[model samples]
Target: MAMAKLVVTAVLVEGRSKSEVARDYGVSRRWVITMVQRFLAEGEAGLRPRSRRPRSNSRRTAAAVEDEIVELRKRLTEQGLDAGAATIGWHLGQRHGQAPATATIWRVLTRRGFVVPQPHKRPRSSYLRFVAEQPNERWQADITHWALADGTDAEILNIVDDHSRLLVGSVARSTFRAADVVACFHQAAARHGFPAGLLTDNGAVFTGSYRGGGWVALERELVGLGIRLTHSRPYHPQTCGKVERFHQTLKKRLARQPRAATLDELQTQLDTFRAHYNTARPHRALGRGTPQQAFDTRPKAAPTAAPVTVPAHYRVRRDRLDTTGCVTLRHNSRLHHIGLGRRHAGTRVLVLVHDLHIRVLSEDGELLRELTLNPSRDYQPQPKP
Candidate 1:
């Protein structure tokens, strides 16, 4: 409109034809003629800036309502919950009874920094969406590196239930050894009931010192508890994404605030974080509800106790060891001196580790002793020093 008016003024004031004015000012001849007539009548007032505000603001959200929507979006985003306009509107209506329209929510969201531009290139799409039907049905485990104030790397092993997002275990360990993980698993199982399935990466700890081949002693134990052990494929961290994301949340949004003094000190912080993560922190998958909410709202379909079944080929042997913790097992006509180490005198034991050996667990399910064929090499790794 302004360009047309300028062309008309040029054509009339300079005594130029429409084509000449159009050529001079670069506007169409018809527009130049039409605007020149309008200018002749309405004068310079016809060349004023148009009103930017909509003629009718009927669709606009009220200032108070818009402010409320913005505030809610900020809060939800800070809590790591879904802050999309549609989600915010639903929440504000259903949860807070705002009953505002989606457009209002969107305007508020954009005004209050609730949206971000999509990245140019994102990771390849994932098809695997973990759905745990019941609590303790399946759990994911991983280890991450933390640091003490002294700058020493601390290996933190974490285990969390897939369904509940419960932090079953998060302990500081010097090494991510299979035996070390076994100890932590025992601690976690003692608190929460034994899981039916364990999901972990193909790290040395999960697959054992010797990789491949079904599973090591740790897998065997999980199998005994009626638990299925599955390993994420190598170079595929997304296979164990639940625990991986948990680690991300733990390090970035939560615990990077303070300096930790020691591993024990870090563990204390972990415990506090675990409580909040389970009960307070909202999960995007859980419809903006916490893990505890999902866990509690859902029914339990998992076993309360560990699976203790022996393999079909394996035969059960109930035996007793002497006061010296040595057991005499008749295998291939050889009396094997399995070291019980003065711990199991007259206890019923099951041989789970290897042939020509037995392990005794007390009435309280305590590992009373492990009678090993090679006692010297059992707990003691050969030392170079």
Candidate 2:
């Protein structure tokens, strides 16, 4: 518009020739002449910029197909399912045997006001992701909390195969204990076969080392089954990002359904979601294939067939000395209390355990006591100093 107005002003007000104005403005003479003529005839409206869109587009998406796209977006969004352009296109192709390209679907959505522009988000290309090379190579596990209609809080344990993003297990419980974590692991293992390794955050149910130098039930069970276990660093949840993300997806689906009145009802909802997610839903990360397809596409990884010789358990736990100046450790599911001198009571200490051998260190790094625990006794008595 500014250029058009400038050319018109140069030719009309300055009395410059159209050819000279075109040459000075670096515009084609034909354009300059047309602008001057329009300005003379229409006064000012002709100088305004006009859209260059063609009168009609033969390749435009058909009205009926566009309506179907909008309907799919509404239906999927209402059901709390993914309704992105790729997903909608996949469904269209499946239903009609031919679908518009993803870009065309996006344009249709934008034209229909179904797309909201977000120019501030970080681009997906900026992320660096790590995935397991084979199915069952690593399983990521996490627990999320939800509430029932009665306002009772429940915990859901979710496990996903790192390679396929398959929801190997999802169960709801009133509260999770170390025993519950072990049970869910075995249930999923029985169905999908044992994963070569498991990755999880440093939750007490997953690991006992953080609370004290002890072995939790889940940790012991995995070790006995020849499966390796890995824990994320303290306060770092991204180490188990797969299962963490799965929680968000599951909650979105749950949010769309009627809030469950009981745990059984919630379990039913989870089962339905798992079926659709594994078999029907298209995963953008998996090239529009479902998780079940990806899980079955390649040979699965498993724990080595040879029996694994379990190494001794070793961990360091930070604690405050109790009034009795004692700390506790659990080995082979048995709890043992070790005695430090009464004088050290109320001091901060670190308890380092290597199998049955124990070393208690003060906060200043001074070794307060050291001893080998006796399996036959619950209390490890201190020696005369």
Candidate that would win on TM-score = 2
Assess candidate 1 and give its TM-score to the true structure: 0.60
TM-score of each: 0.60, 0.76
- Backbone clashes (count) for model 1: 7
Cα RMSD (angstroms) for every candidate in the order listed:
12.9, 8.5
Q: lDDT of all predictions, in order shown?
A: 0.69, 0.86
Off by over 4 Å in 2: 1-17, 118-122, 305-385
Q: Write the per-residue lDDT of candidate 1 for residues 1-385, one digit (tens) a residue.
A: 6686667656777677888888877667786776777677888776555577878788677887777777877776575454567666766766666667777677667776666657785555745576788888889999998777777888888898898787888888666777888888989988876777789997877765234233455765765665666678789998898899888777753344466877778888778877877886666677667787877786665543345655655534434556766555555555456555554566544455446455544322356554445533323221233
lDDT of 1: 0.69
Residue 383, model 2: Cα distance from true site in angstroms = 26
Pairs with steric clashes in candidate 1: 224-307, 225-307, 226-307, 324-342, 325-340, 325-341, 325-342
